[model samples]
Target chain A: MGSVFTPRNLLVAGGFILIALGIWSGEAGIVFEKAIRVCLECIGLG
Target chain B: MTRTPKIINRLIIQVAALFAYNPFLHNFLTGELYRGGSKYLCTPGLNCYSCPAAAASCPVGSLQAVLSGRNTITSTYVVGFLLLYGALFGRFICGYLCPFGLYQEALYRIPGRKLIPSRKVQMLGLLRYPIFFLLVVGAPLLVVDTFGNGTAGFCAWICPAGTLEAGIPLMLTQQSLRSLAGILFQWKLFVLILLSALSVVLYRPFCRFLCPLGLIYGWFNRISLHQIKIDSSRCTTCGACVSSCKLQISIHTNPGSSECIRCGDCARACPHGAISIGFDIPTSQARTVTRN
Candidate 1:
């Protein structure tokens, strides 16, 4: 359907593409690494 | 005499929030915080990672940390998770899941002169977008130290939720942290106190005016798989839904508004039962089907 290609659909497609790219690049490990430490600055102590 | 569905939903989410932070029960009993491996996965709602009882990472904080890291190329995980959430549930997490949202709603239940948001207050809601762009995304990408590391601008400067949920509790629990308290800590504490007081009078002031995570999810509300829908054939624009909506959405005119958290309050309040929530096909496709 012609209406299926609306801007909202495009945005959702873009989101899916970004997710694929993230998995391809191995960013999960980086997220895991950052999660382990309590960043003092995050809670404003630093 | 009977409890409303909204009250039941609120109680269910309150229990969920309690369970989300329940991993460190033993730590609380022994006067210690759990620092564990489970913190790696981001929770669906805005629970602060720094909370002593938190077992999962915060998506917004993780996004900032990844973007501000020396190598920015590896932020796919955080972005992917955020995108997945946005596309699926939008602000449903904000209305029913976020710990801070529950806290604010609980404060609002206190007997007081409730301030219905004025036009000016509604206009202030637009500020969340720029806050998202500048502090959450822009500053992290643009401003970097000599080592090419960025700062979590929103977390470091403005997150009252973080200050309330994590900073205050941590300081009260850890004696060493109290000695290290400085002007920045005081500033954040002041913000926390002010927001807490305001939430008693106004509904979800932080979510309406300052939450970047809400802004991010709002962009997808119109297109998210799970959404609030209104059947026009069954509808009369009697203004009941508008009054029922805590977020001040005009559901008859724009059912899937960005401000709507898919909370189903409007549906519950509707006299004709015109509104519903479900994982339906996109609105445009549904419109095309109607036209044919």
Candidate 2:
């Protein structure tokens, strides 16, 4: 097996780190709130 | 010699992802969107959250929402999720998972005069970058109203997937929604109709030219963990792979080009057994072909 320090693995690690920060910052709750409510704009009402 | 198994596997995954992304079957009957816990997460594909049966949110929609709303935390999360998906699978998500992609392919299969993309047609693909930057990112972040709030410009204005999957279906089911139909809805209908007509001749016109999510995923195709690999030593340069590609990509010349959706058509077409798709480490190739 090659080293885990490949460019691809590094990007994946960065993604995970960002996700953790976002979650800790309560971003998931915000996504949940926005998602649960249907945006009429999306239905072309706007 | 039959590519049936590979085709069937991809088909199965496409159908399964379609249903799995929209599993709240009862919501379809009620004309209500699913407000489940899963809504917090975004689907890897372009399934609209407004679709009554959608179990999760659309990543593009979520990103736009967070951007327009100026919610940095949510923006971080949405970008991270998309990055993870892009890094892991690239546009394999488009080839084997997206409901919209499947729908377009089915439309293309309708017997008719097929149009192979010309050079000018291929040039039009450059439009997606502007669309991604302006509609998906810039407009959402910069265009604000009196309330100092921005809109999800792409979803509101251009997304044919939302129009087909959510708007039209919701309008058909709910009388109130139908009554609310205005010029915008009519315009969306026109866009959807035009795109559907075009899809009959040209393959995946939206993914090639308009889909911001597809563009984002394509950026990672060159470096994604799962990718298409070509063994130059095994290749006979038969050109079967190029002909088989509906997207008009040359896999042997550029094994993991950003334009490639990793659909495995090239691999299946390679009579020499030169091309393969998966996690290939310690990259090995005998020669690189130069196009003239």
Candidate 3:
């Protein structure tokens, strides 16, 4: 929709792919849960 | 008109910090950190998942998770989002936004250390890249236990942004949170305090030394739309702007340094107005040098 092959454009596209891959494969959820667990552990909730 | 900028800035500050408070945005609050980021490349900021008000995912945390790769390459959500953000905004995300950067900038307002001379600033500035590579990525895997699990080294141990926004507040309110306090937490919190103190005396110690996002963004500084330029015709090479820069780049020598955040301080400080930030160098802008 805009300029081709710029850093901003590339990164945005890449970011979208990451989000999609993360959600579609459920991999995103795993990372999210793990991250939350680690962070929660910091405060001893985990 | 009088309060408009203040109101806007404050609102931005709140949105950046408190969006999680809204129930509609709660997916961002409770969803996996990488889940939200994998979906949409949220701005790189200190917005925390645990914060009652934060709805956006933390980018660096998301990055670490992806790099560590929980088995396979993880997911597409993060990549898609990052592509969109990086494509649309480039490094502008670092400037004019990002709550953690804003917080550090605010702390820097404490006003003690004079902006260091450009030469020394340039010398020390080289350290940020290696730190970004080693601490942000390498440390996590290397520091992992026999279970073959890794930690988000930067977030778990060093990032002041996490400490200031997530760790401290959560710990202060929940008494049971005291159980989480350990030697590692205390040690990391101490690092946060040191960075906070440095922010008062210096400018963005973390951004300059340890921020992976800044490391990423800084790579695009020269090509980014919002860029810094030296009006070569106007420049006397007196180096005043160089000394004035908190990021410590030699505007006279390298006007478009990767480390330059395009903060406008150098442009504003120039006696001859020899520096300007824009998409391209100005062929004709005002040119004059005055007595010191």
Candidate with the greatest DockQ versus the true structure: 2
Model 3 misses residue B250 by how many Å? 1.9
Tens digit per residue, CA lDDT, model 2, B6-53: 888888999999999988878877788888798988899998988999
- lDDT string for model 1 (B178-218, tens) is 78889988888887888899999998999999898998888
Provide the overall lDDT of each model, using Cα atoms, as 2-decimal numbers: 0.76, 0.84, 0.59
Q: Among the candidates, what TM-score does chain A have in each?
A: 0.66, 0.80, 0.56
Fraction of native Cα contacts reproduced by each candidate: 0.50, 0.74, 0.45
Backbone clashes per model, in order? 0, 0, 49
lDDT (Cα, tens digit) per residue for candidate 3, span B1-292: 0101223554474455444322234333333233334223344544554543344556666656655653543336554554554444345566555666676778877757645435666466566666667766675556565665656666776666667666776676655666758887787788888878878877777777667676676666655555666768889998888777777678678865767766666777788877766443122222222221
Each candidate's interface RMSD, rounded to one decimal? 2.8, 1.1, 4.8
Query: Which regions in candidate 1 have their CA more than 4 angstroms from the true location?
Result: A1-26, B1-5, B29-35, B281-292
Model 2 chain B lowest lDDT segment of ten: B283-292
Alpha carbon lDDT at B184, candidate 2: 94
Choose the strongest candidate by TM-score. Answer: 2
Measured on C-alpha atoms, candidate 3 has an lDDT of 0.59
Clashing pairs in 2: none
